[model samples]
Target: MIPSLKNILIVCLLLAALPACKPKTAGPLPPQIDYGQDTCDACGMVIDQPRFAAATLLVNGEYLKFDDVGEMLAYHMNHPEAQVAAWFVHDYLSEEWILGETTKFVKSPTIQTPMAGGIVAFADQAQAEAFAAERNGKLFTLDEMRAQVHMVEHP
Candidate 1:
């Protein structure tokens, strides 16, 4: 028995739709920030600030862009749906992306963020200390920062 003409067309349509239904693997993240344009994955805000921008690279190479380091931390703390392979944040002074795990974060009311997160990233601990000295901010590791964000959300 031969397949009907309508059945063949339906099969072709189904085949074409399969790829669209599958989760696509994204390419590497952009090397630099596109301030005032990139949308935050956590809060849906525009990432217009360089110093406060943050992102997490998923294991599949997809990125979850954020407007603030604290927002990123809060998202990671609250969301258990996805695991991040790596994380990046902008340095307050340089406005360049740095490894979030290796960077030090300073959180103070004086260090204002886009979302009022009051978090800043620094490449050097001394620089963080200096920033803290300048504003009485407390320096924290990424883990510590995550915990602090968790506390705020959970408590």
Candidate 2:
């Protein structure tokens, strides 16, 4: 038996409505790699590098982009205590990578910033004084008693 015009119209409407029955979420496919191997230089740990992990730190409008783990570690190591963070970007050139930072070779162990208070211990008072003078800071030496003992009460 032939279907009525009304029934045919209903069937056509159902077919059209079928597409809207299920919702579709659209996005680019997930990145194909495990980013856990990425490391941090300052804090000395691994970084979680993901697309949603975007962060920006600017200085005087001259900005440095450190979305990847390698860049962040480099920034942190040089800055030492600078409030910088990083993640990992896949380097197609050299393949294998770890947490690292770009650093200039310096003969002395000077703190990168004035705000950074680094500990430099010496065996004698004179040597400590000399080092402090060279570095432009107050210096102290480990006394014979304090040298042997690990902890002491500060006056």
Per-prediction TM-score, please?
A: 0.75, 0.26
Worst 10-residue lDDT window, candidate 2: 98-107
Off-target runs (Cα >4 Å) in candidate 1 are 1-32, 151-155
Candidate 2 lDDT tens digits, 1-155? 99999999999999999999887864212223334764333333344534211122333322233333323333444553444332222221233321112111111236231112233233234554565577665532222211222221112
lDDT of 1 by residue, 40-69 (tens): 887777888787889988887678888888
Q: Once model 1 is optimally superposed onto the true structure by TM-score, how far is the C-alpha of residue 37 displaced, in angstroms?
A: 1.5
After superposition, the stretches of candidate 2 with alpha carbons farther than 4 Å from their true spots are 38-155
Root-mean-square deviation per candidate: 10.6, 19.6
lDDT of candidates 1 onward, in order: 0.84, 0.35
